[model samples]
Target: MNTGGKFSDAELMEAIQKNEGKNDAIRFLYQEYFDSLSSLITYNSGSTEDAQDIFQEVIVSFVQIVQDGKFRGESSIKTFLYALARNTWLNELKRRGRMTQRNKLYEEGRDRFAVPPSEAFENREIRKQLLAAVGRLGESCRKILALFYYEGQSMKEILEQTSYENDQVVRNKKYKCLKQLADLINNDKIIAENLKQIDHEQGF
Candidate 1:
């Protein structure tokens, strides 16, 4: 009955299914994941309490998968947990109607399918840069880009919202806005300096 052996996740899952070793197994999971998940949630605009709630929900989903024999072996347990937690948080944000592009990008990065670490990092950085660039755009351009990309609005929809006379006008405005945003990212030396400071502080 020594439950201290480092059981493979499969062994622990079997015990969980049998209802004989769930507490110890779950305890191990809590001790292992609580802090990391808390940091992730907090960084994604959640409070500590929100983090706890999401982590509990994640545990419930994980348990359900184990009980129902749906724990596929294609992804590692860590990847599965991250995906479930991220999606749970994103759903919470959507329910509140406060889904930010940053949050959307983060969940997209955490997706278990079709993402490698390098690409994920690159995507995350690019999104951050893009957001900063958007912040610098004029109000009209900013609104246009937000409507077009964030709201998934078509050119006609954008024309109506922006009071543009035609689809061609809206399309041209979008192109200029995108170019301005790109230029902002390129010309904003402050961001580059801040990045250097961050790298130095992080010892990277």
Candidate 2:
């Protein structure tokens, strides 16, 4: 079978398992799968950078299964990948406190895709406000926010990424950056009104 056009997970696996050089097969999978996966992450409280990091982790996990010869073909490749990506995103959301364990468990039980409501207009507005506030933040502040919240990097990892001498320094910096962002949002009357409108719509 041609290694293109969303190969059945079986077909992709067969090719991957048997092809002496299945780099093209792997590349085809990435091209077809990356956008959908990235969009799913972005829709569920992730930024573009968040999307990239999660997708990369998913790919790594997929490859590990293949290399270990542990894929049993019990599920289609796409289905398996979808499940893996969803679980990863849910775990990330939970870690961030954006979602609770109950919501994650509920989502795991459902065959259907759970999406944020179209009526969550206020959340969208808040995201816009938050992003604007983030933009106004200094470079160090922005980097800290992006690394911890957006990239899902741990504080230890962030410490390494930020060139901070220690975790305590990083923690203080993150608090300051978040405070700065909060202050900007609080001071902006228009954003506050928009947020209020959204809160009202959500009956919060």
Candidate 3:
């Protein structure tokens, strides 16, 4: 079950689960699938950068599915991934206030493999809004927040990875970044509306 760097379905699942052939597996997945997935996003009124983010979300979802023993191999991994990417993008469009029938149009004639969509790794609406707020930050704060929050690195790990002087400094920077993000969120009417909508949905 070896040809160049492509993994068979079984090998892909094993590589993701065991972390041994993981790097090669991921690299091959990206090399083989990024373009097609990204094109799907771009064709659906999203930008190139949006495509990148959607693909990253797709990969995160796929990896989680593999790790959690949810990938039952009823379909090939490629088909599963494509369906997952499509569903993930559809979810994003709905979140952005788009209620288009184009999603139905796209799904109408596809051989949507039996593998279901998994959003286990996609950000919830609130967190996604906060990420947008964070994206509005300047370079340093963005990096700090990304390293600390998104990457889930420890303070010590971040200190080693970044150029901060010490833990206190890093904490201070993170605090400032959080405050700035809060201010940004507060200032955005759309984000505030989204928060309220989330709360309403949750019966808050």
**What does the lDDT come to for candidate 1?**
0.74
Q: Estimate each model's TM-score.
A: 0.52, 0.45, 0.58
Q: Give the TM-score of candidate 3.
A: 0.58
Q: Order the candidates by lDDT, highest first — what do you get? A: 3, 1, 2
Put down candidate 2 lDDT per residue, 80-105, tens digits, no spaces. 67776776666567556678655665
Q: Write the per-residue lDDT of candidate 3 for residues 2-89, one digit (tens) a residue.
A: 3347677788888889766677888888998999989988998789998999899778778878988888888788788888887777
Instruction: State residue 5's C-alpha deviation in candidate 1, in Å.
Output: 5.9
Between candidates 1 and 2, the one scoring higher on TM-score is: 1
| Model 1 spans > 4 angstroms off | 112-204
C-alpha lDDT of candidate 2 relative to the true structure = 0.71
Tens-place lDDT per residue, model 1, 1-204, is 227546567766777777667778787778878898878899999999999988987787678677777776577767777777776777678757898888878766656552233223323345456667777789999988888886688988888777788999889989998998878887867666656655676699
Q: Which candidate's lDDT is highest?
A: 3
The 10-residue segment with the lowest total lDDT in model 1: 114-123
